[model samples]
Target: MNAKVRLGEFLLTRRSQLRPEDLGIPDYGERRRVPGLRREELASLAGVSVSYYTRLEQGQSLNASPQVLDAIARALRLEEAERLHLHNLARSSAADPGRRRSPAPERVTEATRQLLEALAHVPAILTGRRSDVLAWNRLGHALFAGHLDPGAPERPAQRPNMARLVFLDAHTRDLYADWPAKARAVVGHLRLVAGRHPDDTALHALVGELSAKSADFASMWADHRVMACTVATYRMRHPLVGPLTVTQQTLSQDPSLGQNIVVATTEADSPARTTLALLDQVTPQHGPARPTVRAGSG
Candidate 1:
């Protein structure tokens, strides 16, 4: 996945998604060959030469300024996240060529572990880029991945990916009543990661593995859906905790650790909350369950 190809593909997609009328361009009532704006029309809107836009779309001219990138983004009517992603992609390509890429994360810090331990009562987990449960609190372990061990070293390179579990693990599939929606979200998040980190060989490999293994994944990946799920309410059915309607909150990890911390909570007077309380009473203390952390499946 070369950055140029990704940039071009995204541009092409956005271009095709816009109708002439949507962009305030008058149509001549002729039958259209494509779904969206033509290349020349887009180039004209962005105030760039048609030949230059053609070259950029064809992955010939790799260098594009932030101003030019922003122009193209506005011309295509990109959303906030998409605009940021566009800049990130262009910036990544601007890095010195031939730098060895380290896609997979090795380890999170002890400070991060202490942070997780400090929030033992909250259902909080610090996840790597691939959604690897790097450090999870006791309540977090019980809430999201009940069967897994909380006290385990989840290095980015060596850990279970949450996306893999959603599709491959039977228990996880059963947990989500609307499994397809959740599945789409996982693929979408992975898609965003792929776009931002195209040089990430490990990410590419992970995506390849999932695409080959799950047909659902293959279909969604092909659709090119991309979104970041910062907040969501999940309907979960855990073996011990019964049914739960937990609202999830996501916050970015500190700069040193490029991860996200997810916290889940239920309404105070809800049955789900009561079930959580019961689960706490039954398993009050966090301990060293096993040497290894089993976050879903193979």
Candidate 2:
């Protein structure tokens, strides 16, 4: 989809999620034709004329000033990440069409590989901008996807996408104790990425595939929520290690490359930490361990 269309959809969705009462506007208890604040009401709150705001929302106007966008973001009560996403969408919409090009294939640098080796004791996975698994340490592979081939990340065609696994793979779905929360976080993060890289064909394709394959994903995508999942704690049910809670932290070695190292760590002196140690021992130095039990089987 074009940036203008995406921007319009985002605006429409966010507007529908807000009520006049949310901004202290009097509703007067009259019957309403649609949910949330009307277009004129939102324009009034953003200090813009109704026709101008309507034009922006309809994708008829692409050259929106940053000040105007910021005003609309304020009126919408967007979070910090969401505000950034709004700006990104507006900027991309105004950019020249010829500037859009296919992204280059991502690679794991030697430095990144050395860093992963150093983090062998800890579970760490390196992912590209679209969350494609680029590399992982031995323990990381064992902790996250021991059921799959250990060399899958080395093959672009077979590389596992975090978003796809979360929604479509039964093993991944079973791994998370609170599946819905994880699903929402994945969708939100993808939405944020989409706004930032509107021209990324692979990312758009992934979104399309997920939306078609999973009704849950389709619903979540329509919600238009955006989030940056940097650090979050999740309770997981490992087939071999049983139940454990770990915090996943995303570290960027190079922001310009859009590659991130997601490290999973458990609290010291906790049972989860002990569980991880056991898994680490079983994980081979070269690759993931051979699982005695299949994930999602139990």
**Which candidate has the highest TM-score of all?**
2
- Per-residue CA lDDT of model 1 for 10-97, tens digit only, reads 7787788788998899987888977899999999999999999998887777668888988998998887777877776666656566
Point out where model 2 deviates above 4 Å: 288-298
TM-score for each of the candidates: 0.84, 0.94
Q: What TM-score, to 2 decimals, does candidate 2 have? A: 0.94
Return the clash pairs for model 1, or none: none
Q: Alpha carbon lDDT of residue 194, candidate 1?
A: 70
- Candidate 2 residues 144-262, lDDT tens each? 88888888888778889889989999999999999999999999999988888888988899999999999999999999999889999999999998999999998987787688999
> Against the true structure, whose lDDT is highest?
2
Candidates' C-alpha lDDT: 0.77, 0.90
